[model samples]
Target: MYDLHCHLLPAIDDGPADLETSLEMARMAVADGITTVACTPHIYPGVYENTAYGIRAAIRAFQCELDQRGIALRLVEGADVHLAPDLIEGIQAGRIPTIAGSRYLLLEPPHHVAPPRFEETVFDLMVAGLVPVITHPERLSWIETHFDLFERLAMRGAWMQITAGALTGRFGKRVKYWSERFVGDGMCMIIATDAHHPRRRPPCLMEAREAAGALVGGEEATNQVVIRPRGIVNDVPPSDLPAAALRTCPRDQRNANGPIRASVFGRLLGRKTGV
Candidate 1:
């Protein structure tokens, strides 16, 4: 399986503090069936302050360590980018790292509060050519009041990701409810381990996959971990993958934000290419 969002780099943020712990996380991920993991650290402005250059450098060094120790896991570049005013500029200037350098990126909204123009920012990003993969929206503190906003975003074009742990009830009842809703409603496209530590937030997705299989069919559950994630890392257009919004909810499969010039994601690509 492919874990498109993970905090595996050492001392880079709230993740592991040293290389040993990072290596141990890698082992845990490998054992859990995640062969490829995107080393996505936080890019909160004054907090993490992680840059594409620094993240890539850290990944290269960490990957080298893994190789020396015979760990088969592959690391790629990504960032849990907080909603910033300069987001478009950062991506345009190459300061922000997308998943595996693909056109898709993980956009993390503030957990505590719902900011202004949140939906507009997400739409603007899709128009600007980057597919905003909203990370772990099910766990957002204000999700209860923003369910309609989320549905609108999904209908428009944004991709939503639910954390793997949330599906297995690691975060408690409310969070698991939202996660299951996202899965059963076909609002979430990916299930990623936003893993921080080996125990506190370990890199595990199998339980979530099983839980998803129970909610959705086993095939759709497989798509979350294997098919859709594989397509994103390879830069495949979103239309090519199974439409998440169309699974159980037909309303979101169409353009909720007016007309589209082409396929939901093909418009971003300017062409139709297949995997």
Candidate 2:
């Protein structure tokens, strides 16, 4: 499996603080059946302040360490980039790195207030020939009201990356509901670990992959975790991949109060409640 979004680099933002922790995260990721992970740490100005040059240096050093330790996982370059007025310039200047140096970039929106001209900004990115893979929209607190925005973005050629843990109930019922909704409605393009640690935000996608298979199908789930991610890392354009297949979620077909076990995740994850 290829995890396109991960925060495993040491001392580079909210990822593992040290090399030991980072290595442990790698081992955990490998155990979870992940072979390559794009080390995408946060790149918010005045906070993470991570740049393309710095991220490359970290990847080179980290790769050497992994080789010394005999870890087989491969590291790639990316950044969880926040929206900026000069983002297009930054990307054009090579100050920002895309996914594995692909045209796809992990675009993180504000968690609280909706940013000004968000859609326009994203369209600008697409105009610049950069694909913005919106990260963790299910976990966004405002998704309940702005749910239609996701669908609109998808229709306009943007892609959404729903977090893996959100489907496994690691985040709460609210997030799980949206996660299922996005998958059921075919608004999400991929499911990534967005993993930061071995335990807290552990590097695991096998469970979510299974859950997605149950929601969509085995083949489509494979596209999300393996085929499509590989294409992104290899710089394959989005138009080259299969179109997202939309399907009604069984929960909505049944009822809102219906048990989730017979529907999206509870049945797959061995849970007891709905939502």
Candidate 3:
């Protein structure tokens, strides 16, 4: 299997703290049947501040280390890029690296709110000949209420990636509920570990694949984790994707509760609460 999103590089952003831990994460990935992993460290300016050249260098170093240790897993260069006003400029300047040098880019939206003109930004990316793969929309609170936004994005040539843990209920019941809906609706085009460590949030894809298979069928699940990811890394257009089901999620399967409620008072008190 090819994992298109993971933060396994040492000392980069919030990934493994050191090389030893990174190697352990690789071992865990291999045990989970992953052969290729894209080292997608966060590329948030003024925060992670990871450039394309630096990510490439880090991937080369990690690849050499894996080779020295006889680990068969292959590391590829990429970034989980935070959306910014200068995103197109950064890509044009080669500051942002696409997935394995493909036209596919892993685009991360802000967790708390969808940026203004988000669809237009994605449209601009497509116009610039880059495919923006939106990461982890199921975890975003606003998307639960405005699901048509995601469907519109899909229609505008954007892709969605669901985290493996979210599908398997590792994040929580809320995230899993949405993840299932996305997969069932064919809005989620890929499933990746988004692994950050060896254990908690470990590199595990098979469990999620099995869970997805129960909804979409085994072959379709394989395509999500294997075929589509391989195509992204190899710069090929995704093929044999599961056809969108004509049936929407049953009413009973839909969340009865409304969107996650965030309190302005809680924010003023410096306390965070959600359900």
Each model's TM-score, in the order given?
0.89, 0.90, 0.87
| Candidate 2 local lDDT, 1-275, one digit each (tens) | 99999999999999899999999999998888999999999989888889999999999999999999999999999999999888899999999999998999999999987777899999999999988999999999888888877777877889999899999999999999999888866677888999888899999999999988888777778888999899999999887986554443466564566423222222333433432
Which 10 residues in a row give candidate 2 its minimum summed lDDT?
Answer: 259-268
| CA shift of 203, model 3, Å | 0.9
Q: Would you list the clashing residue pairs of candidate 1?
A: none
Q: What is the lDDT of candidate 3?
A: 0.84
Question: Model 3, 58-177: lDDT tens per residue?
Answer: 999999999999999998989999988899999989999999999999999888886899888999999999989999999897877778888778756688899999999999999999
Which scores better on TM-score, 2 or 3? Answer: 2
Report the Cα lDDT for candidate 1: 0.87
Give the lDDT of residue 75 in candidate 3: 89
Q: Give per-model CA RMSD.
A: 6.7, 7.0, 9.7
- Model 1 residue 89 CA deviation (Å) reads 0.5
CA deviation > 4 Å runs, candidate 1: 245-275
Candidate 2, superposed: residue stretches over 4 Å from native? 248-275
Better of 1 and 2 by lDDT: 1
Clashes of each: 0, 0, 0
Across 176-257, the per-residue lDDT of candidate 1 in tens digits comes to 9999888776788999999999999999999999888876657778889999999988999987888652222233543555
Question: In candidate 2, how many clashes are counted?
Answer: 0
